[model samples]
Target chain A: MAALSIKDLTAIAKKTKESMQISAQGPHTKITVHMGTCGIAAGAQKVMDSFKEVLEIVDKKDVILTYSGCAGLCSNEPMVTIERYGEKPIKYINITPKIAREIMKQHVQKGNPLKEYIIAKGYENIV
Target chain B: MGDSTMSKETKKKEKTQTIPDLNSVPFFGRQILIALRNRGRINPESIDEYIAHDGYQALAKGLTKLKPTDIVEQIKQSSLRGRGGGGFDTGRKWASAAKATGEPKYVICNADEGDPGAYMDRSIIEADPHSVIEGMALCGRAIGSTVGYVYIRAEYPLARKILGHALEQARAYGLLGENILDSDFSFDIFIKQGAGAFVCGESSALRASIEGNVGEPTPKYDHATEKGLWKKPTVLNNVESFANVPPIILKGAQWFSAMGTEHSKGTKVFSLVGKIVNTGLIEVLMGTTLRDIIFEIGGGIPDGKAFKAVQTGGPSGGCIPESLLDMSVDFEELSKAGSMMGSGGMIVMDEDTCMVNVAKYFIEFCNSESCGKCISCRDGSEAMLEILTRISEGKGKEEDITLLEELSNAIKEASLCGLGTSLPNPVLSTLRYFKEEYQEHIVHKRCPAGVCKALITFTVLEKNCTKCGVCFKNCPYEAITWKKKEIAVINQNQCKKCGICYEVCKFKAIERK
Candidate 1:
């Protein structure tokens, strides 16, 4: 392997950082799927696929789908958090693929989150 | 390490899905993630993902501007101590190795985390293996060493695989192999998988295992920094200690020193498990209060169970009662409170947990893990386990408590290695904190928490029974009998007295006598 110069290493690091910043600057809606062990065991995979299919069906351009680890609540598995640009992030627990479709259609599309499935709301104020 | 397959699925999910920016959440404020900064945020397999988070900037700075001794001096200023429970001064160890007159010095990152509940090291390796490698390479530069080894346990398959991949990436990118980053410093690292022996986590035993020996700790008359693997000077550091190095280098030593207490610098990661509402990996500053960790971070004990005690350190460490919950968690304070931080395993217990049984559990662990090289640790711990078992079985005499204390102190003093020297911690700590519980068992033959099977008798309270059948359905031994519209009965002949029915009883139908 060719030796990397100091300039080359610095440039690579700088490029990586710039790319990371680019992703953070958009006004996109972020949906975080909790994919911890409990989440996976409780059918989080199918839930994630449901989200992907829903977004594709709607042709949502600015929705940024993400994944997170366990929130330390194993009992409430398959949790999902949705953060819009200006609204408070809403956390929904014990979700299924059917519930994922409802979350996308009602919350993501029409801005009406189902209050019954919500574990936490107004998380923005805590931050 | 215990559940790497599960974590691997999490990692795989992380790779495909975009990660939420943690800066926007309140969750980041709860943790100080120096070692785990890029864990959930970045993809582990991608070196560029690590670099984007300001990783390896320290190695770049160290190689370009600083001399070998200058880096050592910076570490000394940081006052960073070893995180693998020893609490030795890290910079001093480096200085000793740097000063030692050896032709070829080696650096070893101790990833053999054998503590039962401790997975802090495993999490670091699995989540951010590059950080550990970068830290190792920087240490090699500082100590003027060219070769490094990460002695991880075979049980940590995910960590070993991830670390092996990271090393290959580093070599391909000219960060590990010859002429690293076009500098004069050339270092390479190898992964040595331990056969999952708890004793191999010790420094001498690890070195012996690496050298194809029986993995028994030799007398530590000579430090490994002077004479280690193959009789060469070696710098051995824990996984967390090495992971802390790059951050200290990139952000100045003063920045790293500013977070923790006076003696212990930087954040410490802990595997917080057992009876807590939030049982996960947590990283906090060195001097954070135990109350804050247990209440604020752990979200307190689950199901309204009152917190009884926390077993810190590991099998080698002791239990801290509820009275000392406000005690600051640092190397000195925890040791002063009769528990050394053994690789940061915090096992929380509730009021229902039996203190005597807890001591017995740790004694059994130590007895099984003790290498028979030392007769005192081997035979002495067996004797302690036997006595603890007898006490829990309602067969103990009043003299057994004093005998246990005496045997523990003797084993602690006479044993050679760390396993033997700290073998008495669990028994001694329980004796110091909850001696009354032991007395209750020996004198009254009563197990207060109803954990000891031989001491407790399970009886069904007909008045409290609503024919719910919860206990009958949940009992593993099939000891409970009930028909429709009838109170459940526990057959004395069939009952193993395992306490499953007691735990499962929702209406307080099962009573312990």
Candidate 2:
């Protein structure tokens, strides 16, 4: 592989950002499954599997699915956060396979949140 | 268009709903994420995702815009102390390494997070391995080292695999290997898995293990920056400390220094474990009060139990009582309160926890993990563990407390490495703060916390039983017998006193006496 120049690095970052943004502003919908060691131990993989099944069935091409590490709340593992473009991200806690399907269907596809399962809304202020 | 109207409708609906905002909840609101900026936000395995979040931008800036000396100066001005618990100045360590007379000076990242309940390092690598890599590269440029090694524990297989993949990706992107990012400087990092010895977390022992020698620590007569890793000048920083570097470089030292206390700058990531309600990884600014961390961020202890103490650091750290909960959590303050911030493992204990047993638990950990290089640590820890075990088992004498203190002082003074020196912290702190609890065990021959099975007995309180039969069903030893609408009776002859029944009882019917 050729060594990248400083310009190459910034261009790659820009291209990835654009690709991630499906619409003119951002992706239509984004789903993040917390999959840290604690989350995995609490069956986050199963939750992710459930979301995948629902997303495939729903077939929303503009929606992006991803996973990240522990979100600092381990006791509320198997957590999932759904963000509709230009809307507040809603984090659902203590999620199970059944709840993941419900979330993908009700929140991700239909744009209505499952209020009983929701832990919080919006993003944390990053430093 | 159609999307704009849909978003407007959803925003209106969200405003009407009562879902708490992330900033409104103290658990999320209280934290300031610098080192963990991309933790739950990005896919850790993807380089593009990391780069999109401005991941390697600092390394790029360091390589292109700044010289090695300038990088070191910026860090020195930041006052970022070692997060690996020694609280040493990071830039000073680098400056010494840069000035030290040696060829092939090494940069080592200490990822061997062996603290029993601590997973801060493991989680950092697993979640944001690139951040650590970028930090290491910056260190390499500053110290003029071509090669670096990350000595991670073998037990963290997932973390190791993710880190290995991260290294490969960085190299592929020209962020790691030869002539990184088209700069004149060339540097790379290698992973060295440790053999699961707790003492190997010490710098000298870790470097020794890397050099294919026994993982035992020698006296630090000369600092590792002068002679380390095959006797070459080496700059060793912990995983979290390395992870903090990129942000400092990107945002400038003043921004990093503005958040923390007078002495300690930047945020520290703590693994809030044990009996807390919200057990996980959290990053708070230095000098954030323990009360805020425990109650506000951690959501306090679980199961409605009264808070007895919180153990800061690891087995090498001390147990802080409820009185000091309001005290600010910084390196200086923690050490002043008889505890050191040893890699930020905060294990909360409830009222049910016995102080004597807690001391015994830590001493036993130290006793087994001791390298036995010196007589004081080897014999002293074994002797301390013996005394603590006797106390917990109701065999302690009146003079045992004095004897333990004397042994602790001797071990701290004469021990060869950090393992021996800090191992007695648990004992000393508990004896200082919970002296009455210890006296109760020795003088009254009773464990108030009912944790020491030898000192306590399990009984079913007839008035509170309510014929629940919950304890009877959950008891593993089958010691509790109950008929329909009758209070449960525990058969002491068969009872193992495992505390399962005590834990499973919902009506507070099972009593430990």
Candidate 3:
């Protein structure tokens, strides 16, 4: 691979951001699976695989999938949070592969939420 | 149709009532993520995801916009102190390394985190390895060094693998290695794994281990910044400290300094563990109170137990009692209260936990980990551990406490390294705070918390037994005998005083005598 110059860095950052963005502003649907050690111990990897399978079947191009670290509430592991464009993000706790499929079908494909598994709505005010 | 409409209406009501706002939860609300900014937002394996979140922007700015001296000046202005327990001024360390006469200076990231129940460094590296890399690169630019080394432990295989992958990605992107960002500056980082020795976390011992020598600390007659890593000027910072650098460079120094107390700047990540309900990694401002961290962020003690004390700074730190829960958790305040903030390991204890046993456990750890290079540390820790053991076993004399204090002072004064100096903090701080618990053990020959097996006996209270049979079923030994609809009887001869029945009893029927 070739070494990137200073100008190339800004260009790459801009190009990646633009391509990764689903809409002009941001992704229309974003899914963040908490895959920290705590979360993985509670079967987050299975949950992640389930999401991949569901996304493949549904074939939603506007949806962005990613994984991050612990969300602090370790007791509620294998947690997944979904954010729709211009809507409050909803966090679902103690998720399973079956639940992941249900969530992808019901919440992601349709606008209605699976209210029973939802832990919280909206992001924590982190300063 | 009428049934469907009714179900839909009920679902709407339940949704509104059950889904609470995230900010309303204290565990999530109390934390601020500056150093852990990319933790739950980006995939660590993907450098493109990191770049989308402004990962290498700080390095780009440092390389293009600022000079080496200017970078050091900005950090100095930020007032960022070392997060790796000493609380030394980071910029001053960098400045001295920049000015010190040497052929080739070096940058070292101390990731050999050995604190029990503390995984903040490991989590940071696993979640966001680029932050540490970028921070180290920034430090290299400031200190005029081309080579950097991340001294990690072999025990953390996952963290090491992730960091290794991140380094490869950064090198491919021209963020690391020669001529980074096509500039005149060139810097590369390598990882060196330790054998997971507790004393190897010390700077001198870590440097010595990197040099393929015995992992023992020498006296810091000269600072590592002056003579370190092959006896050349070197700048060493902890995993967390280096991770904070990129943010400080990107956002102005004023912005970083504005978040923390007057003396300590920026946020600190703590691994909250032991008896707490929410045991996980949390980051809060430097001046956050123990009450907020323990009760609010930690969700208080579990099992409906009364809070006894909280031990901060790992085994090397001191146990703080209930009275000082409101104390501000800054570096100065903790040391003032007889505890130092040693790498942010907060272990909460409940009423069931015995304070004397707590002291013994930490002293035992320190004693075993002693390098034995200094007689004061090796022998002093062994002596203190003996006294603590005696006290916990209900055979302590009245003068034992005073003797432990004297030994603590001697070790602090005569020890060659930090391991020996802070070894007695657990004993000294427990004595300072929970002296009455110690008095109860020595004077009455009783373990009030029922922890010391030799000092207490278990008996089932008939009124609260409820014929549960939980103790009888759970006992590893056939110590408790019970029948249907009858109170359980503990066979004193057979009982080993293991307290398994005491823990398993749901009705609190098992009493210690």
Candidate 4:
């Protein structure tokens, strides 16, 4: 990304991101990923790839992937947050490509979330 | 005309990408930065990059509209405390130095951060030296100091080199030299290299080293704010402490005070290292619960292991048990939990961490770093080290626990400086919280974590052993042997505690207890 000389960078970023938005599966679902330097290093890219690959196989590409930096834990990388329709976002830690496949197929497609994989269940309700 | 159009085209390309440099993350969302803003985000070697981010704006601002009192008042309202583990009020220290009736007033940035896990200050200097320089300039303007000294460890060659470059850049811009910002303020800074002494981290000892003396600490009884650094009024602030000053001025105190809890205002940075999942620096708002940091931010413990304890505040800090995981992180709360929010070195520990061994490891560290300036610290640390060594080695006495308590208390009370006074923190706090672990080590002659070599012995479980001969090949000392296809035996006498046999075994065969 090149640095802009004009003011209101947030607006430009928002516009760029909003323009690339795809149709949702049902309603709003905020998908968050731990994308810190360490997280990115810990095969998060492949995990993200599996998320896309699973969506392609099922004909569902509504899931949006977002990122946050390291939370001081380098051991757990590719942390995923899946917010279901009208449900709170549940964060899944230690996600690999294989884990991401199961999460998408069982957790996302099945609409029956795995409680064991649910590390943090955030209070933010998906509307 | 062609060159002008090319320049215009380049400018156009830049316009779309330009973003404000301020970090707007939720944790550091409200950090009005003096020192820490540029850390981890900038390359310290590049002088031009620092200027582009408005590095010296605070210095320029300090040079113009603010007097010494005005600067001090701004700090006072912000309620910024020293991040050098002292918790001293930053504004009060500056004000005292400002008001001190002396021929020369001094400002010293204590870059001698010798805490084992504490790199928040050093990383800032290495990543963005200009931020520290700008901070020192603001400090100079605030305390009415003309000359400043930065005493950094020689081990941090990168920090020293970067800090020097920043000083030169500021001078060329007339930010560090005479009539800064075209105003009546004139201030400059000098870099003082430290010879890797943990004692130099103490303010007086740091000051002595700046004067070309041996790195040793004097008492803080007379207040270094009055007669410091060559009997001149000196305001010595740690790197992290100084970094917080500029932002307090640029943004109002309400902005900073709004982020943290009632007493502890603004964001505090921690070097989130050790047994935890995350192993980097984390800057979070004050009052953020310890649970959120260790679990959510830290991604919980690795290998599904339960968190046993978290060692906060470094060698001098105490081990906070999992019972206090929900504790809100502020200076006072941590202190109340028998741990200090020391210089922001937060090392997490899991169930595998032996309480006794961890305590012993810290005591050994403190023992080596101890300058032997006083009998209390020198002898007290030595005595404590011997006791802890005995306990970890399974040769400990039951009565030695009580003796350790008495000796540690005496050391804390009779110690000459903060080093001796706070050296027993790890031992005393560990003893208070995990006395049973020490009892297990001494009375039962066992280390539950299987960490201590003396307390643990390797064994070959017959049922699990595949007789693959992998253990025999991988054993560094050739301790594992197999007489038949049924089982493999580990020669206990020949076992070296290398753990290689335990690792290379495909079958979960090797066991240590």
Candidate No. with top TM-score: 2
RMSD to the hidden true structure, all candidates: 7.5, 2.4, 2.7, 11.2
Docking class of 2: medium
Clashing pairs in 1: B313-B342
lDDT for A36 in candidate 3 is 79
Error of 1 at A49 (Å): 5.9
Error at B270, model 3, angstroms: 1.2
Among the numbered candidates, top DockQ falls to: 2
Q: Please, what are the lDDT tens digits per residue for candidate 3 over residues B360-465? A: 9998998999999999999999999889899988899999989989999999999988999999999999999989889989999988888888789999998888
Predicted structure 4, TM vs. truth = 0.77
Tens digits of per-residue lDDT, candidate 4, B1-513, equal 999989876764453223222132222222333345554223455545555555555665665667667878888878888888978888888888888878678989988888888777766776567777777888888777899998888887656776798788667666677777667778889988889989888888888889988878887777788899998899998888777776666666666667778888777878777777656666777888888887766667888988888889988899999889999999999999888988989888887789888888888888999998889889888999999998899899989999999999999989887888898999988998999999999999999988889988889888888888888877778787775565888898999997888778878888988
Name the better of 1 and 3 by TM-score: 3
Model 4 misplacement above 4 A? A1-127, B1-35, B39-41, B483-486
Candidate 4 per-residue lDDT over residues A6-92, each given as its tens digit: 222234435544533433544345455554435567887788777777667765445655444343334455667677665545667
Error of 4 at B426 (Å): 0.3
TM-score of each: 0.88, 0.96, 0.94, 0.77
Full-model lDDT for every candidate: 0.83, 0.90, 0.88, 0.74
Each model's fnat? 0.22, 0.79, 0.63, 0.09
